[model samples]
Target: MAGEQTGVGIADPALEAAAAPLLDKLVADGVAGKLAAQDPTLWGSDAEAEASIRLSWTTLHKSSRPLIGEIEALRTQLRSEGIDRVVLAGMGGSSLAPEVIAATEGVALTVLDTTDPGQVADALAGDLQRTVVVVSSKSGTTVETDSHRRIFAAAFREAGIDPARRLVVVTDPGSPLAELGEAEGYRKVFLADPHVGGRYSALTAFGLVPAGLAGADVARLLDQAALVADAIAADSADNPALRLAAALGAAHADGAEKVVLADTGSGIAGLGDWAEQLIAESTGKQGTGLLPVVVENKDAPGFADAGSDATPVAIGPATGAAKIAVAGPLGAQFLLWETAVAVAGRLLGINPFDQPDVEAAKKAARSLLDNPDALRGTAEPSAVIGAVEVYASAGTTGEGTLADVLREFLATAPEGGYLAVQAYLDRLDDASASLLRSELAPRAGVQTTFGWGPRFLHSTGQYHKGGHPNGIFLQLTGAADDDLDVPDRPYSLGTLQLAQALGDGQVLAEHGRPVLRLHLTDRAAGLAELMRAVQELAR
Candidate 1:
């Protein structure tokens, strides 16, 4: 059998033996009620955030059973109000869950998680008269979310509609956003459990309200999620979540630095963004983390062929491989990975609950806006290769040629390190990202990750700069065919996008990371050439 056809699968027979000892220990710990005890020292003796760490465990239980009435009421209310669409504007944890749920369930919802003007404009492009604008933020002060709220609120008013009547706010109790929602007379305000953290709040009001509003079966989803808690509490080897945790922890210890994930079924792919943030932010501190790289099923071999150092953990059915399959188990997946990340943190001896370095880039980007002089090197092409041109930072060694810079970057990657493909192009095709991932990792003999620009600056960007220093950064940028301007800012949306890229690159360099920037006159042709270059280098 490839894996458990019902829940999650870690089917390798050898891994069963390797994982038994750890699984036994963890099961014993849970059976003894240690895991649920909310001890801060679970990760380390000096761990300081016990209160926050303990809250995440209760989220599954509290959210699934207790919040059913509130969830149903809101769904009924939305239907009666004739709301046909909902636009959720949030970032990271607040936005990823709804986006995944909307995709899996085929719901009428749009998630705006970027500060890119193009994305914001597209999300609000629909008819606002029938759309409920959900300005969602756990803290109520995320710069991107706030910007989206202001822009859309004004647009609604300009259309002669009452902004308050068409708006809803979901936030923690008494948060600045909740207060503002009340003051602004939003149509409704849904307060989340104060103790639940954003990432772990998938089963909470943050996700349920939006999922319900979008027409998903909230009750069934909760029922499925609750089973995860029960299985975890059972503390047995047959327990799916605990077994997965054991495999992940044991694999990382055996030198599989990269935890490559690929979803086989249609529903499983939707879990990528949420899984990335969950694993990256949770275990990425202390310079050791099980880097969770989400790959499409077809592209699994790219990382699988990453020599001896890589560990490819399949999340879906593949053609020929004994691998884990967490596909088709939507609610269980959310809890399963959440459990795995916490367990991995314990095994790695790092605090799983805190994200200590996520604020640095935000601060850096804000500083760039306040001081234009600090925006790093100009966005000019240093060398032209067919349709592409390469740019290097001021002190970069391979100054004149793009190939030289790429070769230097690839060679300098530490043993077992990963390559990050950060594309800042407006119209990059998913096929292109997949192709790059499939072709790069094996040749480089290291794990590879890909994310579109500006969006990634909010997610894995933290790990690249602050988690560990073993990353090679390849930035791909191109000219937009069309550009949109911010409502009142001095720069166009395109300009802001470029500034964000440069600002993040600057931060990476200051941290002594390997960084290279490529500019393309024609993105399609440039991407093809890049793939060829990588293939040749690998040979």
Candidate 2:
């Protein structure tokens, strides 16, 4: 059961049986060339509805193979030009893959996925002459990536450097970003295949260009991905991706809504982040989705115990684990989850390719940018202690105290409900988030989720607003010691972050969600306040 025959080491008799019929239908429908005609049912929609079903397979094509050589050539050229650091300016699908590769391979690549002014400054801290910035977005119109390009391009010009020499673009063909890149004299423009969605673009230029620029063996990564694609084509129980998909579908059917991922090896450190965006944005809709909670350390006290509706999956170097490699395992995982989530979508009766709710917050943030006065009206603090401010966004009509408000909200959590703790701070680590979950889980009597500002707005925020009304939301944000203005925009990075936070709150409030807002003087104080609040509630 633990041998290579299991492929990625997923072995379960019940799940295999449950998946047999669906697997057979898929195979007979011409998946992996098992039959003549194609099967649109595999993606839970017709060909007209879900057009990007097999676009992921393009990465394995002979035609796409040549791009590996091109990426290698570009890598060599950048090295020759003495570029030491490569900063990836993007978000969600565009940034997650490169972040994982850079972390796994120990490359000098930094992903700026946040609007925190401190983060913007930190990403551009090094010498402009020695750095190359890769601006990536599948839509070519993501506000965060565009803001990054403008700010950094301004910084580059102010330093007496040619912004074009230090800039490259990765986006879909004919996207506005592509035209802008060409007009601005970009060093190179790698257009991704238009059919590939952002979450599925890891194998496209969106991911490879950054990974290659950061010195990863792009060829090897693709080689590993091809192997997984072959396994999926086999469409057998032994196929790792199929087996994993069956497991996920079966688990979901059995009422395991919380999918807890434990990523131990540094090889796939950022895999959870990538998978979070994919799983949340894809499967989360119509009042259902997989709530993926990535626990950095499973042995950390409270996480070892899961609620009744939780599924614990471990991905690391142990025997029967996903089996870590320098880069192969991560690539294998990128394909594995992509296939599994699609299959899971079929099981859940939802379209896995579309994200309808992700645009609401984007639209709201833009409206704030257009009319800054519309950002007026702060909710009176329900409670302010020390440098922390707390405002209940939902279910505030019957509150006695801030603690009582939290207690009342937690008390009303429906069976199989979850708590989402959103922290809008400069810190990116999940230690505090995870720690707060440790305290809140037993007290709230439900599973807990922790996400930083704006980033989660693009990912799980969809589920919180559109999916089941079972999420109890708590948002925490803080002031920064230093704030940098967005180049050519009326607001600073800090203000944009707050606007995005408030915009999301407005949307969630409009949807009748139970949300509580908290503002702290700074991140350190914010995290401490969150810890104290959880500890008090735990009592």
Best by TM-score: 2
Query: What is candidate 1's lDDT per residue for 394-461, written digit by digit as tens?
Result: 45655534455666667777887888888775432323744776667666667788877776765787
Error of 1 at 184 (Å): 0.9
Error of 1 at 407 (Å): 3.6
Candidate 1 local Cα displacement, residue 181, angstroms: 1.2
lDDT against the true structure, per candidate, is: 0.70, 0.72
For model 2, where is the 10-residue window of minimal lDDT? 318-327
Pairs of residues at least 3 apart in sequence or in different chains that clash in candidate 2: none
In candidate 2, which residue ranges exceed 4 Å CA deviation?
1-41, 44-47, 52-54, 57-63, 264-266, 300-303, 317-328, 397-408, 428-434
Please give the lDDT score at residue 228 for candidate 1.
63
| Model 2 C-alpha lDDT per residue in residues 410-507, reported as the tens digit of each score | 77677788888787766544335546765777788777777877878777877787666678777877777788887887888887888898888888
What candidate 1 gets wrong by more than 4 Å, as runs, is 1-6, 48-54, 64-68, 76-82, 303-306, 317-319, 376-381, 384-389, 393-405, 425-435, 480-492, 520-539
TM-score of 2: 0.90
Residue 200 miss distance in model 2 (angstroms) = 0.9
